[model samples]
Target: MDAHHPWNMIPLPDHTDLNLAEIDVFTIDGIFSTPRLDNESELGYSDHHENDLSTPVPSPVPTDTSTTKETWAETTMAPPPLNRRPKARTLRNEDWAPVKDRVLELRKDKRKRLREVKEMILTEFGFEATERQYKWKIDQWNAGKNVRRNEMKAIVRKGQIRTVAEPDKRSLTFELRGEVVPKEKIDRFMKREQVPFDAIYSPSSGAETPADGILDCWTPATRFSVGRTPTPSLSGEALATNEHSFFVHNISSSPALSSITTLATSRPFEGRSPRLLHSPLAVPSSLEPNDVRLRRQLSNLEQSFGEGSEPTLGTLLELCNFLLVHGRYSSAETTARKQLAACRSLYGDGHERTGMTLSMLGQVLMLQGHYEDALGVYQKAGVILKQTSGPKSEPYLRNRIEEGVLFRCLTRDEEALEILRRAEATAQQVFGRTHDVATYAQLRLILPLVELGQFLEVEERAKELKLFYSTVTPTSQSRRIIWDVNHSLGCVLLRTGRLKEAEEIFKSIWRDAVEISGPEHPASLSYLHNIAETLMLCGRFEEAFGKTDTCISSRISVLGLNHPDTQASMRLKDRILARQRMVSRVSHGDIVQSGDVM
Candidate 1:
């Protein structure tokens, strides 16, 4: 069943008259032995062969050359045709370097109008971009920017240094303060950290209760009934006691828990837990889409907006976002469509909100892999946005970008190129050539160009982006772009039969991807897969096996065992193992030549 097997090329021998005496057999020295078939029936031959085996048997000769030739032709099968599947496009680290800096600058304010930004991108950098592309870039930049901000704030706040937790109980012990801390504030922090702190109290009796029932010098954690010993009275200079001294030191003790404050300051108990290093989505195969938190949110929203009550625009949008984030695609799509219908009724078909609803519906559809449906939705949204808002608006441009993406997905390269070209030109005219939108448009154009076999254009754009990205201050986003540009060039080199150069490029990309995204990141896993493929091409099977194995494990962990890429990784591993077995067989003289997997 393994078509990749070399034995598939050799046809099955005719069982009708297989001569046992003339069979040439060889054993692999100290390695493996082919078991002998004691019973002729095992080989599907008649019992007559066993009875005549005691007598000396002569090799049969062909009486007629033509008949012998025909027999040989029938017995020997042709090798299976070589696989000619078009290689799947590798993930390219495309950079829109032309507009990166300006785009980043304009994207800082979340409230900026898309059209205004798009125009800026067009005018500033001569880069063409649609709003959707802008949104994507914004998301990428925001992800990195937000992480940096959190890290900086965590460093600045110095909260972890001020707080300490009890190992057995979730309470922290602290000295009495001259001023009382707000109970509501401490309660909120405790609730977020999932700590069971009911209230803050002073163990020492002589200590002032602090009218608001708040403890002085408290960092967040307070004493609880769940722990070891009762606190001694704060009377008679108890501040110098071991308990007070120990509490202060313990509050500032842990360096490991600093990330907790950063995570808590942001949205706590959302996406990835603070205890985990990566998001649940990034964890690969361990996600439970129907977790309790998601279900509670869904149920709460549904009940709050009863069947008789029409959901508001905000409520519907919230539901849609929540569902989408949770990977409930079908529900998200339904919610989006409902929102769209509501928009048509409330705002009319020509309204800007209606166009936005259509765009939301299209996004849900696209997520569900309904590309054709999404394309149609995007087109409708585009028309509405253009008519109601204007072609220069963000909504209209976002839809335009989506259309180009859909075309590419459908393998309509010419159409994709045409649409992307227009988008790029618009960005350039409005924002200028150096805008991120224009750069992104250029990047999008490369996809179709690669598909169209325009390697020269691909190389030119990739090299340009790579060089431009290198000039900028290095950030995760910039490095990612550089990696993508290099990836494109590597793909070109591979296509051109420059194995050594391609291997080096892949190696560097893999190393960088791992550094930027971590080894378990989907992108890093993909780069590792490329390195394995390159190694295999170079006949370094041993190294290839190691890389492939790691890739398979990472894919299975992050993407799940049933993911297409994971399965492909498994298949690649199989091929490497098979090749290794073939080599081993040949080395031990079990087979005369390579790929003789009889």
Candidate 2:
């Protein structure tokens, strides 16, 4: 703490060339000092005269006035006043601790905007932060919460945590389209446990025998497959072995069982699909939206039926559909796998149930952009359905429509058009043109036509479908179909450069979806995205940026941050920003050029 030390001294003025005698130095103890001058007497003051308070030192009679004036001017001139530095205010842990709970509460109140929350925190708890800082802190908190929640979910998935009660023996019944099956039938089906495949195989006869042929009569093959193909005869050495050993050999060596075994053990999306490898929009495992009631019900069903039971398979299928409808593709894929496993174990390969499950799995895979894997799954499903349900059946036709959609997604327009046309014709033949199934098949054809650049054909078909739906009394299913048709029409308009019309259509679709499913639903978000894209194309950068940002945030909450849709929105946001920058530059350049001309 030495006063003369550089650290303790006052900082020098910015101008280093100033004479030291002209600068006033202030010490730490409030004393003013200056460098000693060699000619104080010449300036009309003396050191000895400073000691006498009453002695009048005579002012020098104006001798050499010009020289004295120059010296006084130098001494009286002041260096520029030091600028007082502002203290930097930083947010500290202590500062955040007091306001954290209130800030989070305000955030949860959807009615409160970020600016309002920041203002409330500042007013109530004296927490100071800029908009950006406040948003960053909240985001960090949310990220940490997500990590902890995911960890708990992982533990629950591993069976280390049981959030539901133990299974009850009471029967559970599922209502399908306002029809309830008899309790006796439901209980009987639910109580049927999975038996080992070897249990149904007999080696004593040494002849090929169909497994569970009697059980096949209990259920319709169209609903669920109960029949297994006849097993091939075993050699003499195989017959001598134990039943378990024989079962192992049968699974590994049998050509019919090879596909089933491979499906059960191998990952459906192992290798990258050629078409999706470098695609920016390739789908990943999207996060499921939080639905406490549905989740609780699913958990109870799982506990009640146990794994590998027929009821479990049914429950898994329901869960998969729920996930898919909510745009939770990744979760749907996982649930579909469980559904497939249970189907294979209970109904065996080549069962109609297995085929239907495979079809659903293929649809999920296709949505995730695994086109190759989906194609293989679709082929397997087609073969099984052809054998069990015939090509003319509704399930087969639906599967074909989905396959055609997959082709459309992959941009294989010609192939998609052909397949979709055939499916539509077949659906019309089987179910009639006005039937819901046939109408859906027809509605799906518009997108492929649009992709093929057949805009006129697409517009005509869209009008026909729209007219048909107008005449029919509107139900939830019909409304959904109508929305889809309009969405396709909007796409046609968008691609054809009718930006204003497309934007209006997308906005209408968004409003309808919000009314039907609420604002946070995936369908609503999708329509919102369409509007955002249309706005971007129309050069409305500000509106487009805001819409795209909201879409990205909603998708992150519902479908997860890394989902393809969210990624696509982020890309759109970047493009919007780039366009805005370019526009700003062009306007600025114009101004500069105009000024130069003036």
Candidate 3:
């Protein structure tokens, strides 16, 4: 027998010798194969028949098993085929391509729910997707539509080919009319046909003119001059009585003139003579002399060029700024509204000029303690600025800073921090750290940081701003920036228990603020409050009381008695008095103890 043959590999009894051809390899292989229930039952029956003592099993005639063994071996050697589960269906872009238009149409129906749209897609296009998936696709399609619409608007604005007919709702293409007239030629034509202000405001100006009845209230004046020169020395009463006596004498006859007179008289100066209180032109004495002059100039511009004219609008904007600087927020708001209207008409609502006017209006609103209204106005300004000048533009960044400050004022510190942080980073990236806009943004961040108790970061930024301010020229804006930075640093010092240092810083800032923006200005009053707080903390009760009293009075005058700042001053006064009483009681007890010892 060959040593390597299959028969040799099988073990057998030591005393038994088996013929290799007679060995049953199939039966041997069956012993190692997996046992099934049917095979096991058949094997049991065969074993029972062979082992039964009473039953004599018939001996079957033996046949050649080689053919059967060869067939069994061939069948056992072949491998079985794999039984795999099919792959799950996946969606592809091409699948959506065929049904995108129908999906968009379905999306346009607001009554259909997202689940409905998903089911519709599955039924109509055999594309299975979730409601969220369908919503995402619809959003993507809408975004693309908006992008294409903006592109078309840009093309039209550039004076390129004009659209003859509007695109059909189901159509994806536009019909071109023809090439538009050149922008330069249109500009020239407009300039040639533009109406002169002189003709519009003349006595003979007709009601049927393009200006309509806008100039009806305005008195006709010399073509190139304001109606009258302003006299700074004349009191409001003297001006109304001597120069404009006709208005007072005939105020009942002209309703418009009477309304103007009533409007002027309603805003009388606080400290004016009782006799002059009856005057129709009693302007507020709170306005600075320079502000009064600017207001006069603005009035003259309006009288000469009508309120809608470009020159008058420019002066109106200047007057608004002047009023804002003087802390005359009410007047500034009125002036800003007039300017905004003119800007909208002259330069359109989306123009940069209109956006800037909105920004000024927002600032005035914010300063007047109207936080909610100011927030809405700021949002409008921000949107307009973002569209006209972009988000990174200086004007837009400055507006963001203002908005953040307004948020700070409203005590929404987290939102304020988020906005200011982004604006500061963008400003630095676009305009460098040393630029005024970046510095302004950095300065605005301090209050929010202080509110959030981020003292270390606030201190570090304040130090950087201080260094920056040193290298810059001292302008009105720069001075205000310096005041704000120092005020914030003083607050940090006060919060961190550096009382004397904080007191000195606040005192310096307060003096500077008073000189720059006057004693009644909100910033000046705020600095006064800080100084009082620092003095009280340092145990300088007498000086603290004086500062607090002055702050309360000034706040009451400028911010009204019900204002938060004025109320805060009142609370500080109470605290200072409490501290003083405690100190006095302690001193008295000490005196009694000393007497007993002596």
Candidate 4:
């Protein structure tokens, strides 16, 4: 079955026409009112009047019997009188402009009757209008205004624009939250908007060529062992100088980009990892602390790196990784951009290296909640990789996964589901269903389906994953996959209001994850949170509160107080407490009423 076609489109309720009551007066007493009967004298008077009216009434004029009979037949067979009133002119967009203000005023006041409004419209504007047309116009005006208002508010909140103006006079001078927007970023924006690039900068200044010296060293490489660093195969035969090798070798020594398997194998569906395609680690606290040793190492690298040197790219990548893993996404984004610029300078836009750096920058943008920008970057990276590394390559698949994630974040659930479904098929065909790439795609596919309220499909996919893992060796990775599947299924159950089943699943998953990975692990915390929610829904308020407190404390310790998970736990606790108070008040009121009745 096509996953894309599985989504159920929930139709909105049919709209009923507005029915206005004709009578102004209504009373319950009218139904119970007694009926009065006429007395005997009044009945006798009515009989006397009936007797006096026995005389026959006569016609005013005589008529021919045959002609009258013919006329009667003609009258009986004649077609109904034609509706002689001319049809009203069809309404147009420009025609509506004249009455727009009147429609808006009447709608805002909402006190005038539709009949009165219609009459007023005909009298004042010389146009016959119906109540339905008036209502539709009002709705259209409000919807357009609301859309613009929401869009402006979003732009303002993101600090993308300083102020919102009228639609006729929208301002284009962007006021970025920080320093100037990069040239690449602006170029991308311009291209999307279909603005002429020549209007901003000349082709000479906008386009940069890849260094010819860099591409001469391209060579096929073998996969390395799991524990060993994966080195680029820049063979001695292909290299013109030792400097390139030194730069490449130095880059490999820095913190290995926690491989894709680190994401697929270990990180559960929690924290930023759930949103990311290949997050290095689940939480920031686990990243290496920035101490004197790290500072000295960076200082030494900076001292050795010269302007326009290839080694600078390695340094930039290091800085970007450190910043990103440590939750400094804004700084990481800047550094990633710098690294991308350097990569482009060396390897050009279409090179695999440039595509990788671009994908990294997109992830950083995602971390910072710039989903629109991140989506654009992900698309660019995907295109570059598909052109240079083939569509079946791992990088391209990863790009699709990240794009799906971004689409999900942006609340474009159907789009996310479609992209993920396509990617999953590709992964299954290219890498096999059991491979980590396919598994990752399968996992990501569940998220958007859940958002779309397609719980059955979610459950089916989840069950398939569980069944697949059941046959495999119970490695830590396999266990994690099973754990994630159960967690997601439990979430679907919770959302579908199967409180008891969901609670049981959450308890079992939480217990097992805690035993395996400890309470501080993101997976355990997530399951614990799920338990709290299920408990609350089941009316086990006290237990829910206690569990939530524990989850929040653990999240604070493991992730940080400002982490979204910790804040969400705190909010859930507040809601649970509020519900408890409300239930208590209602119970007390019921008891008081019972006592009074007794």
Candidate 5:
């Protein structure tokens, strides 16, 4: 990582023997410079062998600050001197000569294929477009010279060589418009070029394409493969492995890099395409937007693994999309388990990414209702978490809250309450009682109380929560927690014979929260259902029938007919019928209100 090492400006290979057709390419800042290829190694070149890409990548130097970069192959072909411009003298840094020399030493391969290998590497790194069938496009790629870039490089701007962004290098446009490469066609090509394990020259893989047959490919991540145009996962990295040869150059690595996740290609079915872990719907409450900046930071982490980054953005993107779709699940019991295992292996068990992936996967498990599975994932999370903040960390408390929730669901009330009480106390001490953190902990604790059937505790917590909600401006998640708490309190009131009070709270909340959170929300419906039961409990037959009717309609629309909510509605209707019969015996003619369901 020397500051003055020879840098790779173009993403193409430094060897000279690779075939242009088999490799793919794109512009490096739209300025092309011819690259010098290293001399051939004495060793015989092997085709189709899996390059132990696990070979250690040399630590990269600061990319933006360096000079004396390797020019692309296009730079070697000079056009007729414009107006016989004065002969230019090239500038190469004295300090960087050693780094360049070292790279040359490392790339000791057979000279016979040096040009072809270098060309293939460049193609893999996105130094040119996918070589076309037409002859004209190939000519333009070979001529990487431009009058404008040469002029730009002359002006020393803040001690850094200025590179212009390539407006014409709009790769995704051709891709997105469907006017360019197709997946099936590419897959066919990849299949044809797929070399045997013994023949692979670089750490790259080979896809057998019908047209080319056993083509060399340096895929970014395990699940996603792009011919050229640096994928997001591997976008930031300048250095790449083309089979056995390791070429260190410069490219943008991820800004939020906690550590890199390795391609877990070590499955029993190693030759097959690697599969990603599946995700569930209903993301965990933990990753909610409590901190927008942190959310964006993590999003950048996702983006860093996205289309333009190194590795393949597709693999990471798929993971995020899956997590977003599947509510938090029991990672241990599902695909998340594989995800955690793979991430830890790549980044090492103690890395920060290990924590992020673990938390997310654990949350996924939690949402899946596999309480034991969730508890296990959280415990695993705790192991890595302890390294950073010890056992008494905010993160640890958050994980504990999840464990407590699962415990409550499992009917281990005493244990659940104990864990949450300690968590609540810790969170309040660390983040303060008035903070959203404390409120979040409180809400999690309250949910357990509801499952434990502790009405008295629910009432006390509800009063504390109502005051908390009233005083603080809530976030979307905080509001949800408040609404859920309100619904729980209303249910406790109904169950404990405080029907009138419960009715008032439920109706008021429905009127206010319906549009804000939507009418069919699970919390909204629970409160509404409680109101119907409360009316029935009060023996207001006419009013009770009206509430029951609304409950039935809402349940049918919001939750399908056979759902538990719908069944509850049916039970309420039966209760209404019984109350009507009892009231009929007392009064021959009772004046029923128009709005009354009866």
Candidate 6:
């Protein structure tokens, strides 16, 4: 049931009329993948086969009351029919010259943001700096960065430097702080890398005396004692009110043992801890409502809340992760912060999950336009995360992505470029180049390039992004990228008068979305709308109207006329209808709404 599969053109329900009252909307799993809530993805499930290009192609929607154009005609001179099989640019590097300065400016802005983040981290961790440090750092780096080719030649003659390689030329390469020299690695790692603690100390390397308490840094590990957050004994717990039982479950982390041993002799609690009194109710913070199994799980979770049995830390973390994904953006922020605070109290400052929750909270804040807050959170996440996962773990990677995007929003291109470029490089090193994660990072770089209108670079970056979906791998990640990025690139092509190419890209995505996510999915609808608009721009009248008509039918049937998606579909339909009226005077058998526009 891949909505974007070209062969799976979902049939719209047989609604004889466009009236809202008559339309019956029902939830159908797999109708379309929920478009990734992030703007980069269209409404479709991930597993949909978006790049099954061999599937039946679809025609572009027309804007006017006229004929439709063959789908994807830009790649080949001969156009393919919407239902027929069909198959499908280059600007020079200097052609990007016009946008170069702006690109540099943006890149610079990005750097400033990163600089801010580093400073924030330094401050948070007590890494102090003076104004003089800023000048010294930048001046020293820029001097090396701006060295001229001629100057290099002179230096080469002096045998002062070795030949540089292209890949490493612009990047910083160094040994892994080989030695933790105090001067080199200091407490002020916010400014310069530093070891977190001073020399370690421990008590006598033997067992503790009866008079002495168990805690001793000298011991390789901490010993466990009889203390534990007690759970209610279920035998009589039913007699206790929910409030009292709930308190027990909530505070059950402090472990106590009747029969206990240190790390060497571990045992389960005297009895099964406690039954879950409830399950979480809030949905994932960033996921869309139709995100398949995840949403269904959330629904099940809702009923369990205030009722179910207790869950372990891992289970709780997983639930929190889900909520961090689907909850309302603002709510996500608050919950993430609270969760992180709780985790910090439970696990201490150095735990990875604590930083992860904080980073997730930062993502929510950044999305909500809270830049300064995001910067602070990212800094904290980055530093704490690096300790265990190094710089390449998922938590660190995601935080970097967030940082890159945040910089872009702030109009700091250099920092965005610097961080994103590093991110991409790191991602490639961590995940293979063609991996879903790596490609997405590549697109992060491309997004800025597109804004700078460096089509050449955009094309280069886009090629990598597209390659993931264009070929057979077609992972959920690739499919998502293709659906969204292509739609985005089409917008650019449309503006650049690469009309033929633009038309092809739009039509293909529209058809693909229909097949993979189904016609009613938001992404499919958006693509359908785009196709129609492109057709209208190309003066294809009847086809545009037909596609618009089709889109409306699908939207009404799949999304229920009252849904937000259905509403947006109607607006797009209206735009197409208006264009149709302008282009062709004939009142092609009117499909009238109940006195509603279009």
Each model's lDDT comes to 0.54, 0.59, 0.59, 0.57, 0.45, 0.47
How do the predictions measure up, each by TM-score? Answer: 0.40, 0.51, 0.50, 0.44, 0.40, 0.37
TM-score of 1: 0.40
At residue 93, candidate 6 shows an lDDT of 32
The digit string of per-residue lDDT tens for model 4 on 14-77 reads 2243233421322221222111112213222222234343332221111222335445445333
RMSD of each: 34.3, 25.7, 31.2, 31.6, 26.1, 36.8
Error of 2 at 585 (Å): 5.6
Model 1: lDDT equals 0.54
Clashing pairs in 4: none
* Cα lDDT, model 2, residue 258: 53
Q: What's the TM for model 6?
A: 0.37
* Model 2 misplaced stretches (Cα beyond 4 Å): 1-257, 260-307, 311-316, 328-331, 560-562, 581-598
Model 1 agreement with the true structure over 1-598: per-residue lDDT tens digits: 5558865543443346655775534432222223233433433343445444343222222223333434644432322223365553332213353344334434433455778877754543344656666666655433222322222222212223333333343333322211223445445544654544432322223322222211324324432212222222221112211111111111112343211111101100011100112333322233533222333343454457642134456666776775554344434544565565556555556678877877877776564445665676777677678878888665676678768877887889899989988888888788877777777777777778877889999988987887777777887567767777787778787778788999899889888766545676656777788788888877799899999998887665544465556777999988888877877777778545444764
**Model 6: how far residue 554 lies from native, Å:** 16
The TM-score measured for candidate 4 stands at 0.44
**Stretches of candidate 4 exceeding 4 Å from the true structure:** 1-342, 364-373, 390-392, 429-432, 474-476, 512-520, 550-567
Error of 2 at 553 (Å): 3.2
